[model samples]
Target: MPQATKSKDGCINQLKIAENHLSGNYQEKRESYDKEEQLMIYLSKGHSPNDKYESYDEILMPIGALLNNTLNYQEKNEVIKEYGLDDEEFKERMRDMCNLGEALELEARQEESKRKDVEHVRNIIDEFHCSLEKAMDILKLTEKERQEIMPYFQA
Candidate 1:
């Protein structure tokens, strides 16, 4: 048996294929299929050309159902129910996912602030031809901030 495609590219490709197929572009009849049919078509597209995704149906079906914007709240709940997934478990997982996203956003913002601080220090040094300490002092950076950016100057 062929291994299932677990890469991000595979998942993205499958979504696109499903979207096109359900939009009536891939079939002779448009909007003739139900939500379940749409999901099967999406899961069938997997990664490899010949990938039947025998093992991924369960894993991918819920994701497909959730991501399909055409499905309303009741439809999504129905589809999810068919997979034997618990409502409370799914809700908990969604909360976890949201927390992870917020954490990642915070980290990214902190990194951007650090980069801007370094850039400001570099600009001050170049414009005034002063030492790192003098440039940092001109910017009124705190001791902790200076220490944080010190390695960047060394690099």
Candidate 2:
């Protein structure tokens, strides 16, 4: 028999519990029915498990802990210490991950802003039945903005 039953609701409930714990909204202690569940609970609380991971999913626990926004630097360091990782190396890797995440978020925002600008320009062209340059001129778009949206018009 499987040690723990897998269900959508169960997974969601577990996630909610973890989120609550991270947010300081849940303070009650819960029992772990199995080793896998225990490991998950520990990971959620930034506590490292004693046993080595036996599967790919288990291996991702530390990564998840590292990426968790609610876990402070000290908590993350504790996780690294428990996992027996090199302190400096793990801290550097964590910094890289943080920088990458921030970069991706900034890129996404820029793309969205550009998309909206393109849509506005298209709307202007449709409303005025004008050329692209004329529509951009009416909108008073800067040279950089016009250049950024030019590729959308070309395609």
Q: Each prediction's Cα lDDT score? A: 0.62, 0.63
Q: Which 10-residue window in model 2 sums to the lowest lDDT?
A: 1-10
Give the per-residue lDDT of model 1 (tens digit) for 92-148. 664455456567779999889889889999999999999999999999999988888
Error of 1 at 58 (Å): 14
TM-score between model 2 and native: 0.52
lDDT of 2 at 20: 38
TM-score of each: 0.46, 0.52
> What overall lDDT, based on C-alpha atoms, would model 1 receive against the true structure?
0.62
lDDT of 2 by residue, 35-144 (tens): 32322322343323333444543444456456665555666566666667747877888777766767887999999988999999999999989999998998898999
Whole-model lDDT for model 2 versus the true structure?
Answer: 0.63
Instruction: State the displacement of the C-alpha of residue 64, model 1, in Å, after optimal TM-score superposition.
Output: 8.5
